[model samples]
Target: MRYISTRGDAPALGFEDVLLTGLATDGGLYVPESLPHFSIEEIRSWRGLSYSELAFNVMHPFVDDAIPADDFRAMLEETYKEFAHQAVAPLVQLDTNEWVMELFRGPTLAFKDFALQLLGRLLDYVLEKRKQHVVIMGATSGDTGSAAIEGCRRCEHVDIFILHPHERVSEVQRRQMTTVLGDNIHNIAVRGNFDDCQRMVKESFGDQSFLGGKTQLAAVNSINWARIMAQIVYYFHASLALGGPDRSLAFSVPTGNFGDIFAGYLAKKMGLPISQLVIATNRNDILHRFMSGNRYEQHQLEHTLSPSMDIMVSSNFERLLFDLHGRDGALVKDLLERAQQGPVSIEDYRWRHARKLFDSDAVDDKLTCDTIREVFERNEYLLDPHTAIGVRAARNCRRDPAVPMVTLGTAHPAKFPDAIAESGLSIKPELPVHMADLFEREERCSVLENDLSAVQSFIADHWKHA
Candidate 1:
């Protein structure tokens, strides 16, 4: 399948190319030329297969020509073999009609592991075949950095550098990334918000001279199509376990970058019987406002309990707009430009169209804590702040009594011990083996101002030393 840039300027690329060149040249995200579909019979036939098997089946269409079938299958199997759960993303019924898809079963104890684990394998395979090395630069609000660091820490052919907003992420989040002792992993604490970190990454890509000068740079964020593709497997797994296309399912995703919910959309396009995709947001609710027809306005960032969702700019939403406009890149570019200048008012019809496929709700800190307390009291379930927002949002939109609603549990509660404790729940979850003694480790990272030259210089210096 060919991938095209949302801005219509970059050359169309195949799966591997799209995976490597994350943000398109025209400052847009890449999307598939056309979505591939799967028949209901084909989806149902995958009922009892292992997660790896199911992932191979679901992702084969997208990367059929990019990677050899046997190699891809082997990679998928190897990528997930170390997961704590045999059923990689297990489903637990929270209520008669509600379930929580436990996605923190991988090494990092975050939903990002579902994709980054596979991403590490894919990167190794591709780089080995080409006999090349790459520098992976990513910006993370919280979980993505730790997951990426864990996935690519000691890999010989790839060097990963993650930039996170200083003092914005939670303590555990910071420690997870900072404490990794891998020589190849570099963490930069930027003196700005998540948007600044994200902008720096984008600027690095835009610097043609710098991009061509030294080490090859790729991104591990959801901007990489492979990351989103890998995430789609869980939706299929959850849907199939809950009777699949036979019964419609609704997903409540704790959305920040929009990639997670967009994967659900891809599942629907591929004929999964999903009724609605609910976007659960914290105070940084650009997505919520867009879906609510109050205009797609990006305000100043806010520090919230759910730090991962503390983003003013939702990057993956551009891909959705590209699809929504029927792959008309010109329209996508125009809309994005307008949205950036100010809050572009989405037409009522367009807003309703988006709302048809997805519903949105925002939960503040109080509601998040309340939901955590309530869920713990009623069901003996302990949720992190982000997952608590999702649970509350799901409860607000719980209309269909028959259709099962699945909320994507994005992170393990241990990642946010303070919030979890503040919610009046006491569950001392075991840390992942890698993070067991994070506090004891001394961190090695550069504190950088939000300047492009400084970031560029850091990359240049690192490449030169390597």
Candidate 2:
């Protein structure tokens, strides 16, 4: 399938190009020119397939012979083979009608690995065919860094660099990225918040003069359409597990970047029988405000116990805005550009239409902890802070009691022990067997200033080609 930029200025591109090109030349994100929709029979036929098989069926349309079919299947098989769980992404029931889809069973113990593990393999296949090498510049609030590093570190043609907020992410989050040592992998701790690191990555992508024209740049962020593509698989997986296609289901996603929930939206568009979509956020709740009240305005970023959702700007929201404005790229560009400076307004009809598509809630730190404690006491299920927010948001915003509500369990609780402790739980969440010695591992990471030019200079200086 071919992809077009949201801004409508960049040339339409095939899948391979979109996979490698992070941001469009016109400073917009790539989306499918036309999405594939399946009939009820088509979706039902996929019931008994393996996760890899199901993912191939759901995602193959997007790839569209960009990679040979057998090769693509092999890549997908290898992608999920290393996951800690046999089912890959599994479902755990909390209430009779409420469930949590555990998504942290992958190598990095986060939802990101659902996409990144396959991303690394995809890069290897394409870059090897083209005989090319590229640099990966990604910004993470917490989980994306380690998942990206784990995914790309093994690709010889990739030099991956991830930047995260200094001392803002939990100790486990930091160690997950810093402990993975390789010549091709570098981690930077920015002396600012998650938004600062994200802005620097965007600005660098806009102007790559710092690379001195030696190597091209790529993205591992949700801005890349491939990342969004990989995430869409689990939504379908969860629905099928809950007897979908015949019965409609609901999803509550804990998202800061908007990529995860945006995938759920796309799933609905692709003919999944979804009754409702919930936008679950923490105190940094631009998306929650927009969905609940039609106020698409930014507020000062807050540092929260759920550090991953501590973001002010939701990047993937622009993709939804593209549709809300009826794919008028010029209109989207105008609205988002104005949004960068101040609050921007959407048309009355568009705002009302969006309300039909979503329900939302913004949970604070206290409620997050209470929800964690409550769920543990009620069902003996220990939730990470992020997932706690999802569960809370799901229950608060649910419209129907009969429909199955699936909360996207975004991370392993072990990764956020501090947040668990704050919930007044007496038991400590232990790391998975693979990461048992995570604390004892020696970490290698550079602490960098948040200045854009300084960060760009470091990438140029240390790039393998340099």
Candidate 3:
């Protein structure tokens, strides 16, 4: 399988190149030229496979000929072995037809670990083969920073730098990135919002001449195809666990960057029996507004209890628009260019096509807190602010009651104690055993202004790999 950029200008690339190339030269995200499909018999044959086994089956087609099957299998096995749960992404029933897929069982206690853990390994394998070193730059709202650090800290050929909005992320979220001590890991607290940090990362990817024209730049963000490829596995795992293929399943994803739910879109493309995909957002509801009401407009970014979903710009939405526009890159390019100036609307048919499969709702901080308290009261289940939005959306926008609704538990409740406490519950969630001493750990990070040149200089100055 080969990957093509959404803009349709970049040359078609194999999986290895797509893994290393974060953003296309034309400022587009990479998607497979064609998705692999599984027949009903093939889907049914995967009933009892373990998560790793199922992941290998789901993703192997994309990784075609990039690595030997045995080596790739071993890499996947070693990657997921670090997760805290045996069912790597397990399901917890909240109601008879409602369930939560617990995705924080990995090293960083967030859904990002599901993809970044494997991405780090994949990068190491490919870089080792090519005898090359690259700088991995990413912007995180909360979870991706720590998860990327944890995943790539062990990689010798990678110098990983993650920037997060200063004073914007939760304490646990901040500590998770700053606490990890590694020679190759660098964290920067930028004086801006998540969108600012994300814009800087994207700008840097567009122009890497700051690396002295030798060192290559990579990405661990959802922009990278590898991250999206790794994420698609869990959708299959979750759907099959709920008796998919025989019966359609519905997924409610706590979306921020749009990567997680886009994986669900790809799963539906690859023949998963998905009835609908729900887009759950906090106050930064650009995606929700677009999907729900066909108003693709950006508003002022809000600092919410769910810091991860506090994004005004949804990056991966372009990939869906690419397909919705029938793969017309020029149209997507025009639409995005128009969007930058102000709110832009797609053609009537395009809007209607997207609405068929996607339903969305925007949950503010008050509603988020209320949902958390309600879920705790009803099921005695604790939910993080992000997952609480997903649960609320799942209930409010579900298309059918008979179909099993799986809301992605994006992060552990302990990660957002302030939000949980604000729900009027006195209970304080504790860190898991592995992160028991998270508060006690010393942090190392640089406080930088949200300027592109300054951040680029820091990467150029401190790049040990270079």
Candidate 4:
């Protein structure tokens, strides 16, 4: 399968090239040139397959020519075996036709492990074959940093750097990334919000002359096609478990960067019978505003209880605009540029078409904490702030009561104890057995100014020369 840039200016590439190339040369995300559609019978046949087996079947079309069948199967098996749960991504029912897809059962205790664990291995395999060394640069609000480091720490051919906002993320989230000490794994605490850190990474990728030609730059962010490919599997997994193919399901995703919900969008395009997709957000709600009104604009970033969704700029939204504008790259380019300075909008017909499948709502801090308390009181289940927002949106924006509404549980509650405490619950949420000593672990990290030059220079000086 060939992949083309959303901006339509970059050259088309095969799956392996797309995996490593990440953002296209024209500063656009890559999407498949043609999505492989599965018929109802084809999807129905995959009802009882294991998670790894289902993953292989769903993702094979994208990576078939990149890796041999048996080798790819072996890597997938290895990737998921590290998950703490046997089901990998499991579903827990809350009420009739209402459920939560628990995605934090993996190594790093977040939904990101579903993709990053495999992405690290795929990059290693291709780099080793070509005898090339590369550098991975990513910025995270909370979970992605730890998940990426855990997945790629053992990689043989890459030096990975992850940046998170200093004193902005929860203590547990910061410790998870900082405690994992390795020469190849470097963590930076940027003195700004998540958007500042994300911008630095994007700017560095735009111009990589700082690396001095010794290494190629790679991405672990959702902008990488491979990460999105792995995420598509769980959407299929959850749907099949809840009786899919014949019955339509609805998903409410707590999204910040728009990658996770974008994966759900792709699943629907590939023939999953999804009735509705809800865009759940925290106070920083550019996506929510766009879905409710036609205006797509940026505002001041906010810090809420759910730090993971604290983003002003939704980077992947451009991918959706590329489609909404009938795949006109020039139009997408102009729209995005205009959005930077002020509010930008699309044609009324295009906006109305999007409103058909998508609905959205922005949850504030009080509602987030209240939802967490309410869910725990109703079902004896605790929710992290992010997942609480997802649950709230699923209920508030749900159009039908009969359809199964499954909110994507983004992270483990143990990872965000402050939120649990703020919910007025007396019980303390303990960490998992393996991470029980997380607070006691010695952390090593460097604090850097939010300046792009300082951040880029740090990576250049510390990167292991090829």
Candidate 5:
């Protein structure tokens, strides 16, 4: 499949080229030139396949010719073989019509592993063929760092560097990234918010000389189309379980960077029987406000109980705007520039159109903790702080009872032990076998300011011999 940049300035690229280059040269995210569709019969025929088999069938069209069919199939199988659950992503009934899709059964115990595991395999396949090494630099608020590190740490041809705002992430989240001791993995503790770290990563990507002289740099964040493509599979998996288009499904995604919800949008575009995509956000709710037609504004980031969603600027929202504006780069540029300047006005008609497919709600710390306590007491389901926000948002957006609602359980509750404790839920989720002694491990990381020059210098110093 050919991919095009949202900004429409970059040259069109095939899937492999887009995979290797995370962001387009024109400063836009890559999206498929055309979305592939599956007939209803094809969807029904996938009922009895394994998760890996189903993923291969769903994703092959997007990766057309990027990897040989046999190689890609093997990669999918190997990537998911280590999942703790046989079913990979399983659906459990929460109420009569409400269901929870548990997505934290992988080694890293977060939804990101579903994609990052496959990403690592894909990188290995491509790098081995080309005989090249890559340095993957990413910034995460919580889960992505550990998931990326776990995926790329021991790979022979890749070096991964992950940065997070020091002291802003949860204790378990921090440990998950720091505990992994690998020669190829480097962690950075930035003395700022996630946006600061993210900006530094982007700035490094834009530096021509630094990017050329250093080892090849790629990204594992949701900005990479491959990560978003991997996430689209679970949406189809959930839909098929609900009996396909014969019945509709609704998804409640606990979102921060907007990549997760953008996958839902792709699923809808690909003819999934989904009704509403409910975007669950914390107090840092730029997306929520934009959808509500109030204003699209970025304020100072807030450190909340659900620290993962503590983002004021949702990066993947640019991809949504690209589609919303009918793939017109000029219009997308204008909207983004206006948004960056101040709160821009969105017409009521446009807002209503968006509301048809997307419903949004923001949960504060108090409500998030309350929802955690209530769900545990009522249904005996312990939720992490992020998933608690999703449950609350899903409950509020229950406009249709006939359609089954699926709330994405993003991370294992154990990742936020203190938050779970504060919510009065007496549950201690066991750590994954690989991370059982995370707290005892010595961490190795660099401390950096948010300056672009400082980040560039660090890359140049370490990557000179790479």
Candidate 6:
């Protein structure tokens, strides 16, 4: 399977190449040249397969000739074996038709683990075979930093540098990335918001001559095609569990970067009977505004209870816009360039077509807390602020009652205890047994200015030379 840039200027690449070459040279995200479609019978036959088996079935087409079948299966088994739950990604029923898909059971306790774990291993395999070394640069609002570090820490051929907004993340979120001390894993606390950190990463990718051009820079963020490819599997897993293919499923994803819900969009294109895809967001809701009001503009990034979704620029939205504009790369380039200064409206027909399958809502902190409290009182289930937003959106924006509405549980509640405390509940959420001493661990981190040159110099100093 070949991958093509959303902007259509970069050369077409195979799956392995796409995995490492993230954020195309022309400032676009890579998407599959042709999505492999599964027939109803083919999807139905995967009902009772194990998680790894299901993953192999759903993802092997994208793997193509990159890795042999047996080797890829072995790597997949190893990747998911670290998950705390046997089901890898499990579903818990809340109401008659509403449910929560638990995706924080992995090592880092966030939905990102589902993909990052696999991505780390895939990168190691590809880099080892080619005798190459890479530097992974990523920006995180909260969860992606810890998850990416944990995923790639053991890799010998790669060094990972994650930047998060200083003092913006919760204590737990900050420590999760900082406490994992290693020469290979470096954490930077930037004196800015999430969007600032993200912008730095994008700019660095745009011009990697800072690395002296000796080593390639890789991405652990969702801009990497591998991350999105791995995310597509869980949608299939959850839909099949709730009786899919025959019965349509609806997903409400608490998305900031737009990668997770875009995976759902891909699942539907691959013949999963998906009825609705809800774009759930916190106060920093560019995606919500676009879906609900046709305004794809950037505003001041807000710091809410859900820090992970505190983003002004939705990087992956361009991938969807590429499709929404009928895959015209020149048009995408024109629109995105125009959007830099302010908001740009798409054609009416395109917006209307998107609304047919996509609906969105933005929840403020009060509503997030209320939803958490209400769900706990009704179902005796506690939700993190991000998941609370997802549940709220699923409840409010649901179009059909009969269809199963599953909210993607993006993070464990323990990661954001401040939100739990703010919810008026006295219950204290505890970390899993493995992370019981998270607060006790000594953290090592460098506080840096939000300047790209300083960040690049830091990476150059600490990065192991190839």
Alpha-carbon lDDT, every model:
0.86, 0.92, 0.92, 0.92, 0.87, 0.93
In model 1, where do residues sit more than 4 Å from their true spots? 426-428, 432-434, 464-466
TM-score of each: 0.97, 0.99, 0.99, 0.99, 0.97, 0.99
Clashing residue pairs in candidate 1 are none
lDDT of 1 by residue, 177-273 (tens): 8888676778889999999998888888776466455567799999999999999989999988988868899999999999999999999998898
Q: lDDT of candidate 6 vs native?
A: 0.93
Residue pairs clashing, model 4: none
Clashing pairs in 3: none
Please state the error at residue 408 of candidate 2 in Å.
0.2
Instruction: Please give, for residues 1-466, the per-residue lDDT of candidate 3 as tens digits.
Output: 9888899889989989999999999999999999999987898899999899999999999999989999989989998989999999999999989999999999999999989999889999999999999999999999999999989999989999999999999999999999998889999999999999999999999999999987899999999988888888888898788888889999999998899999999998999988899999988899988887788898999999999998888899999999999998888999999999999888888899888899999899999999999999998899999999999999999999999999999999999999999999889999999899999999999999989999999999998955
* TM-score for candidate 5: 0.97
Cα distance off (Å), candidate 4, residue 309: 0.4
Clashing pairs in 5: none
Error of 4 at 4 (Å): 0.9
Name the 10 consecutive residues with the lowest summed lDDT in model 5.
Answer: 457-466
Query: What's every prediction's RMSD, in angstroms?
Result: 1.5, 0.7, 0.8, 0.9, 1.4, 0.8
The sequence of per-residue lDDT tens digits that candidate 2 reaches over residues 338-437 is: 9878876788799888878689999999999999999999988999999999999999999999999999999999999898999999989988899999
lDDT: worst 10-residue window of model 3: 288-297
Runs in model 6 lying further than 4 Å from the true structure:
none
TM-score of 6: 0.99
- 1 or 4: which has the higher lDDT? 4
Clashing residue pairs in candidate 2 are none
| Model 2 misplaced regions, further than 4 Å | none
